[model samples]
Target: MKYTIFSTDLTNPLAVWQHFEGEERVYWHDTQVNRVIVAAGRVKRITEAELADYPWAWYSQSFFDTIEDPIWQNMGNELVVFTHYYVKEEGKAYWVTATDSAPVIAPMTVPSVQHTYEMVTTGDYTAWQSLFEGIQQAIRSGEVTKVVASRKVAFHSETPFQTASIIGNLVAQNEGAFIFAYGKGDAVFLGASPEVLVRKRGQDFMSYALAGTLKKDDIHDGGDRLLHDPKNLREHQIVIDRIRQTMLAMCDKVDVQATHIMELPNLYHLRTLLYGHDTKDSILTMAKALHPTPAMGGEPREAALAVLKQFEPYERGLYAAPVGWVCGNTPLFREAGDGLLIVGIRSALVHGQDLYAYAGCGVVAESDCEAEYTETATKLQTILKAL
Candidate 1:
């Protein structure tokens, strides 16, 4: 099927987002290129086999390892094309024409939302002690070399959350990350993620191995402490090695950029960019293989995942999973439409008045329980501050 695009007067996607009426909605802001795609209303619920029949679709998957939890199942894992979508990039905005005619880009005002909320964080020091010891045992017994341990914090408010406003806040504040949201019914999973799982444009492939963390204030002598610290560098190298091995196997050529400090509002992270050329695999396929990397899961991926499934207190759901969109053979074309999926870190799941926010840290042999706990708490602020 062919899809067309037309110029629109829509300037602010956040304004359009507030007025859109759709049971299923998707929003993606690519900070790397200043691109935004807001999709609303389901056009068709297609499977992996029917991808070519649609111009564009938003796809999401639960974390590779899951449990029998209804909250997650309620936020179904599937692929779908929306009836209407708005795309803006390079100062140009357009509305898409799929199976239905394009709708007028009417002016709309976003309602004022209250930002006050009450929060209750789980995983106290006692709980952290238990998890830290378990991972330490796992590492000692050769069950896994490293594990990324995650924690969840819950928030409550008298008023229901305004997702669009939260999204706007995320976009405005988190300039270094990609802002993404997927809403179905009363559940919305949204975050500003600094880790790109995969990005595909024709045969060009790009991903980032991001691990190691320190507070922005903790940096001394120009991040040299973070750069030279043994524990942080060890954690960062594990991630770099994992991605290097994966890309070497899949691509004709692979290259890694110098590791540098990535500064965010609350923290500083060690980041390295990995790029390659692959003619064999599709974007999603590559993402599936590279996901749950040492940065998010651990080294010796399966063993780390087994550890998480067995001992981690809560189910991850879409917390650190791959969530992104594919524009297959659409007017936004460059031979094959671009694909981008980001790891869902620094994110939250909004269900009405309650919010579940997630954050994690790499637990290496050198990891200190207290330090990791503090790291996760700081990470949670990415969403908390937006709220």
Candidate 2:
């Protein structure tokens, strides 16, 4: 295969994103690294059953999830990359990094589909609050220290929805968040998230443990209130502790970074950054071990996951899962990292006009059913507003 590179000011990368067909489109943007990437045309795809047995990766691609359950074999896992562009940001400057099978040719064309269904699905607030209470009861009984509870609300339209338009809104509005969309055809997962499961740089590993939540518009300095809120702190600490342990066990050397407050557009979280010694076992090794961190799963990982699996009314397909790409034999021109995976939170799934949106809150002993219910609503606002 041949490859070429180029640059341009792409106001709406989604316009370029339209070129990739079927399950061939991928879009990612990170202000932390100051880069916006739009990868199209699936030049290669990699799938793994388990990280411990997976072969060496030779492409910069993204991977999906199966059931995180040990007893069950992986359902559908894939890595996609090498046919794309990487847009980087320097001091007050922006650059687009592109890699392709050939030089650009063909006018940009947008894909279209007719609506096949029209149904609006929403969550039962009373029922969800009841479930949240059950999780909190488990926490009180010492059944699990913490559990992240989630709910889904979907919309089925008579007209097929446009991925380009949804993504355009994401780029135009969401700021300082991990933005991404994976998959194609009628089934796709996309979102602007504030959590990073684990990030691999050249020789370092970074895992972001983000839990706890309060509305950004709740208080003048939400960060200050979030820091002192004992309930939120307890919820956030469980995630930090679990991640630190996971890194120490699976990685060579580990650094447990300090915990701080991270504020997003409509929400705030207690955030901790963890780093592990870099080795060949970077992304794959760490992600498998740290995924579904207490932030997504719960304390005593297995028990909480069991609770979620049994109680949650939905499949969770890729919501609260992992997204982003890994590098191939030849890395991209950018210096952001070896590869990156963002915890697929604050996200939604689109299949025609039927859009399934999801949101969740961490449940601890101190959690109030009504309050936690409110948290999930806060979490869904980003994508809900975007749509």
Candidate 3:
């Protein structure tokens, strides 16, 4: 495998620096390699038969079906670099830190701080409620078991959104996670996720699928009350059951941690951490076994996905999809073949002045519409404040 190094100055970076960007191609950010995966001009809209010719083809409605994953190669070792935003127009792009006085890579620089502000205010709550009602009606009529619905709030700003700052903070704060930042036109997807769907550790591979949601208490002593809630327990169990069945075929050993307290910025969740060790499988194989877990998708995987297809008006695209980094021939710093993958939750795609934010909750037979809607609102607040 061959690798290429590209960079721009720190003062004027392009959005491609934050996201591996190209037209009609799939650009993968291999964080472990400190480089990118680029397969330009290989992507096209094609039939399923044609896609079979490519080994790593992914189909999303927003983008056609003929996309292929890039080939992996070793480019010696590269320095860890960052992106800075210097331009904003029809779409936003950034500059990446480069090695020398070469323009092979675009300019790289962080966006100015004057561009930051909270644009998503409580005024959008009414629109969110209306969308929530639509989802509830579907659930009540049995059209779908669960719909991971979301909404977008526009962050009107002249300066471009900051991508490098958020990624740097996530990497520095969560060493066990993957930092994924990308911009589609003006919308940017900035995610710092710690969850892993599948990871390779030599012959032994692992995955953890988390589910369930709740609100954290302001009082210190409210912990016990939150843990004992029946609603919370049920939500958590649904996720565990879904993951267990999904991985039953591929895992040598599956150990599920009993329900425990886990907290995010806005809310809390009853988390049952599942540990799967594969003896005969690779990480990608395990991922194929479980890519979109019940946490993002729903129980009875196929059925849930089918429901989402019919009921969801907006295309999910990369929202609620797997967003993370892959190790490109790099030894795991802590464990062999260790890489990080996280569900793109509590995230947004910023395109120019329009910001698209996404949030979803697990719905069961006993779930309530108002409460679930509120949960999503809490989730949205996390990324909304950062803008």
Candidate 4:
């Protein structure tokens, strides 16, 4: 039997299926661009018999080559398969989708709630100190400008949870922002970030390159003054310059705004908003050009990544990686091709009761070990409160 393809514009919500148990299914409102195709249920992979179960034309990322696809032709398309669960006083269940849009709502009996816990604790302070010392020594030798390092703590609990619920909570509390939660197998990532590396809203491309950091002190009278501190200015300039250079190589027309200050709950940051027009390159090409920016990774991508791989104790996976959606197969929206990627800062991975969270600070020539440590601790609070 042939199935009807149900693709919707970014503004329209489409009916999407989300699996609970291997046998149970629910409908959710998918208002975003990415299409959902079922590869498997909780009990098993999708079988020929289950084809009828999914009446809508389904798609999967198994075949598409991101690097080869054109940005405009595959607009409104996304390629990540996410498995998420939400746990709270209300109930516990899991849902998988490719976009952030809410799923189609369906009336169904709630499943039996399971009790579980996952705890994430930090590594020993001594180990952190040792890493910091090594980083400082590298700075003295002039091998790098900045290096961002992090650690994780994982604990397990019996209950299952929803990744969207956690993201919703964080985004609701912070507006004009992006919240992301993507999990594959045992690894999960959830972050509420205000900084946008790049957004394609049509033919127009916008980017906010943010760098420099300062902890907010309630007692300080001229706290905002810290945004312009020479150390902070220098840090931010490096990021702006790196982003501008990258954009120029891949974009047809690029314009950058003067640096400005943006405030978060814990601190102030320096941000430079950029506008650009996409070239003929695919989104993946543009992404490759811009990623590992000085903001998330560091200046001189290859060298910085080398330092991280050698010194960092854990693999980053998608921790500081890009997370968002892509849609629209049109030229104007080529870069925006229905895709939105937010930096995975202020994020956590929750399973059972154990929530694995991570935070990293940019360490530059003038960076103080104690100050960077404090900055990471402050960033962790975004996810820590929900747990």
For residues 12-57, write the lDDT of model 2, one tens digit per residue: 4555667664645667778667566666555555543222121122
Per-model TM-score, in order, reads: 0.94, 0.83, 0.66, 0.70
What is the Cα-based TM-score of model 1?
A: 0.94
Clashes of 3: 24
Point to the candidate with the largest TM-score.
Answer: 1
Question: Regarding lDDT, does 1 or 3 come out ahead?
Answer: 1
Model 1, 100-168: lDDT tens digits are: 567765687765465778877654667778888899999999889899998877888888888988898
Least well predicted 10-residue stretch by lDDT in candidate 4: 55-64
lDDT of each: 0.83, 0.68, 0.50, 0.54
Model 3 regions lying over 4 Å from their true place: 2-146, 168-178, 183-187, 330-338
Q: Tell me how candidate 2 scores on lDDT.
A: 0.68
- Among all windows of ten consecutive residues in candidate 1, which has the lowest summed lDDT? 328-337
Cα miss at 56, model 2 (Å)? 13
Runs of candidate 2 with Cα error greater than 4 angstroms are 7-11, 21-23, 47-76, 82-119, 278-280, 331-337
RMSD of each: 2.0, 5.2, 9.1, 9.2
Q: Clashes per prediction?
A: 0, 11, 24, 41
* Highest lDDT scorer: 1
Ranking by TM-score: 1, 2, 4, 3
